[model samples]
Target: MFTKSILTAAALAVALPFAANANDGQAMQAATLNVDASAFTTNELAQIAAERGDTRKAERAARIQAQKTEVPGVTNAGRDMQAAILNLDPANFTTNELAQIDAETSALAKAERIEKILDEKSGATVSTSGVKSLTVEYVHHGRDDA
Candidate 1:
């Protein structure tokens, strides 16, 4: 019984780290999903609602579209598009900055431009060292807009 107990403890010691890593991975994936969900543009939401036959979502998208209050110097459309692309809040950036990002034809280009703009604005390199890499999937809704 003592030998069996020691073996079980040893096995648990080996497995505990793996279990912890699995939990971390799951948490990261959940966070990524949340970002992706929130990154959907109003048009994208509308398209998704239509595809899923979800009237409530469709109506909500419509309401969001109708309720857009333009910021004083910000172009709402460009800001919103860049915000969705970067999985970031639109309020954090200015209209001109978002317009530059939106002008990028691809997601990767946009991300790079954002990083550059941030570096230029802050005068310091943004550190992403501790951030775990996540796969982002972008869905194009047959729009010319990136």
Candidate 2:
């Protein structure tokens, strides 16, 4: 009886740690599930989606979240300036030129500024298809451009 009791105690001692670890994992999973999806970065959302085996859905959710949470101080003037900056080829411009581009307020201004900078840098006149459409739309049947 004493031998059986000792064996049982040993088995319990070994099993307790495994049970505790399992509970810890479950608690962590619960905490993860409770977090706001909008707060997650794109990469983090992608990883979580990959873990859940639903890459497409996660990617779509991430895109939606990104659109909803526009970067601070960024504007959607003329085009998505943030996206344009992200897609811009850094190798094509010097640091000063890039900084100049970043300083521009509107997308149309940025494009025009970039063209001028490139022209000056290369010592060649770069023809820019400038401001294709009217940037401002006046409401209440009135318009003024001073």
How would you encode candidate 1's per-residue C-alpha lDDT over 31-136 as one tens digit per residue?
5333234445534443444543446555655544443433523447766675676565566566556666678877677677767766775577674331123244
What stretches of model 2 exceed 4 Å from their correct place? Answer: 1-86, 127-146
TM-scores, one per candidate: 0.32, 0.29
Lowest-lDDT window of 10 residues in candidate 2? 129-138
TM-score of model number 1: 0.32
Q: Which candidate is the best by lDDT?
A: 1
* Local distance difference test scores for all models: 0.57, 0.54
lDDT of 2 by residue, 1-146 (tens): 99999999999999999987764543454355443544654455544545553566556555545544544234444234433543454444444345567788776677777678657755776743322332423356555663
Q: What lDDT does candidate 1 reach at residue 50?
A: 52
Model 1 residue 97 distance off true place after TM-score fit, in angstroms? 0.8
Misplaced by over 4 Å in model 1 are 1-82, 127-146
Candidate 1 has which clashing residue pairs, if any?
Answer: none
CA RMSD for every model?
18.8, 19.0
